[model samples]
Target: MKNPKPTRQRERHNVYRRVREKIIGLDFSPGSAISENELAAALGVSRTPVREAMLLLTEEGLVEVFAKIGTFVSRVDPEQVAEAQFLREAVELASLRSLSTPLDEEKVDRLRDNLRRQKETGEDIRSFFALDEEFHRGLMDLAGHESSWSTVSAAKSHLDRARMLGIRKIPELGRLTEEHHAIFDAAVSGDAATAERHLRSHLRLVFADVKAVEEDSPELFVRDRDAGPHRRSAFVWD
Candidate 1:
């Protein structure tokens, strides 16, 4: 039996993490082609590892490959974003309800801390978004549903670009902050129903904003006309 050392795993993990972050952070925008040769050269690694990393990203739905053309970052799909939002709400609500007790002082403090940073980082969309993600994941972690965070995180990748547009134009940042506070208070008081209600409302606002952007920026979103019947089912959202 060949035993894999921890360092080898860590190196591979770092490679994949960096590449995935670059893609999700919009360092590589949607439909932007990437060359494995260039990426491997830049990362100072062999094509073998970079190829593996690209494959992992593809599995996460962040990249698409064309047989003869090339590999490009996948485009955003409004319908998929809607579906992701639904799944996120269901998973998170279920997770919150299953919690036996209110969130601990540490978790509550962490959430408050994150919120403070979010407010102070006004107009810094990337930083604010990163903090926002941390806050929600922290809440889910408090509810002992860390694994669900992975699913939500993966789904949110498809929603990010649209969200970036929404966040830029939406003036509801303060309201959003208040919503977070409300959810935190409910969770701290062990009020599952209240927490779930606030959570759903918060997510609904995001969905509305994303839908608006999708309507306004048709080119950025997947179009019904361009999609086949089979693909249309996956791209149509109510």
Candidate 2:
């Protein structure tokens, strides 16, 4: 039998993860052209994996590749955001309902730790973003349906940039932690109804966030889906 190497697959996935995070984190702004060769050079890999990764992202609606021009990060779609909101609210709220009386002490303590870390993140939006995700995933874990979080996470990618945009634009970072506390308290106190209400409200805040972010960076999302930004060279940031 011939020896098989798995590192190539891992390399491709690493490239994908890095690129996807950059996209979701808004490091690569919407509509910014992404060059495969440039990405390969930056990641210390060859273009093959970079190209493959971009293809995978294309299937996920995160990247757009035109026939001749180039590949670029897709802009935030309002429809996608709305749909993602609906799905996320459904999953998180249902998870809340699934919580039995007397939430697990360990998970509750972990959530407390998450909230404390969230408070300490201060103005570091990236750290706060990661913690925000962890808090919600913790909720799912408490409900004993931790496996479902992967589905929610995958479906919520389109919604992330707008959420990230909202976080980055708003100077007061503690507001999110406050909201997390509300959800956590309601869940742990055996008030599933209130927890559901709080979680729904928190998830739907993205709509207002979308509006605000659109006002500040109109180019990040087209007001109308039919209209599109003119393709520019990868070097253009504006």
Candidate 3:
């Protein structure tokens, strides 16, 4: 005998995560249509849970619903991306500063292990991206502020989507991995100042990549802060 409430909640969350990943990974792409019926069929559930999941996404600013135009994957907002990046830097730099001169041996080893795995990922964008996230979150955990990672992650959905688009077009993974190594080296060497400098530079560089991406695909992003949903065809927008 299964409890219906838990099962329903689980199904709703399953749809939410799956759809969220697709949106962030650019599989759905910005301004693309999201068919509730299609997603329900694909996820092997009815429209009830799918609709529930979409309602939540709407609150996250990841989904947009029009009166007659239907729902769509929201466009990447550069302003939102910058705001998220600022929050991420402030939190992560604070964590680095709070770390003791001599870091925990176990945490240092784990950081090194994450870097090694990052190098091994080699062109697997999603895998590398996941590791990149884990590595940053690990830094917070190492500094005794693990719970703060959740707050940072919640605020970074827009930034994450922008990052996926940037990395997909730019061959920056190697450079990014090298930067991670540099940051980790400074952290373990007990040089908080150097570590903060490296991390600030690393976090700031994503905007450069994002700008290049925007230049290439103007339609995928919103330039003006007061912009609203512009209409387009059913299958594509231009």
Candidate 4:
């Protein structure tokens, strides 16, 4: 008999990935209500996989389960964002400092291509977002530490939400694309110092972005630094 464990595990992960993507993309906005039946129906899957997926997300602190209420998307927590940012910045900067003087021209070409697409992406936030991820991942690959991107990525759910908000709020999105160009040029020319400087600056900008977005959409963020699920409408309060 064929073992169903692998297939089941893959299906659960697939469901988790899709749901997590939607959450990060703000389709399931922070602090919003989620109906298991609706979500399962929307994804064209049975409730079992969806339930398992939400369980995984809850473990990741991305979803909250309120007894006698419902499951809710956890509000963006600045602390989590900061922690994730710290992890990403540390790994990326360390990689930058360890870069070889002469970067691979082929890798350089891929980064260039990503930047070109980013420039051409214009104000298409979602498309630009994907390109932005690709550009950064390309940088990691260029340093031959491509495996590090996954670890950086897995820890940055809140950061991703903040970035989505920031991308939406930025008046001139090209500014980020330009930063990518600066980092890429510096790296290709074997200028690790300049590359690291630009990369650090670029990565740190998320602090301001998170602040700006929180100001604009206060409801999308956590209520307080220390709060618990209240009797409120699927939200946590102190």
TM-score for each predicted model, relative to the true structure: 0.84, 0.87, 0.86, 0.86
Instruction: Report lDDT per candidate.
Output: 0.76, 0.83, 0.85, 0.83
Tens-digit lDDT string for candidate 3 (56-175)? 899888988776667788888888888988899999999999998556788778888999999999899999999999899889888988789988897888889888889998766989
lDDT tens per residue, model 4, 122-220: 778999989988988889988888888987887788889988998788857788888889988888888899999999999888567777788789878
Off by over 4 Å in 1: 1-11, 224-238
* CA deviation > 4 Å runs, candidate 2: 1-8, 223-231, 235-238
What pairs collide in candidate 2? none
Question: What clash count goes with each model?
Answer: 0, 0, 0, 0
TM-score of model 3 vs. true structure: 0.86
- Residue pairs clashing in model 3 are none
Q: Candidate 4 overall Cα lDDT vs. reference?
A: 0.83
Stretches of model 4 off by over 4 angstroms after superposition: 1-10, 67-69, 225-238
In angstroms, how far off is 97's CA in candidate 2?
A: 1.0
Model 4: number of clashes?
Answer: 0
Q: For residues 1-238, write the lDDT of model 1, one tens digit per residue.
A: 2557556665456678987777666666666677777777777778788788778888788877656566667778776787788888888888878877635778778888988887787767778788888988888888778777998888767887778878877866777888888987888888889999999999899888988877777765566635422211121111
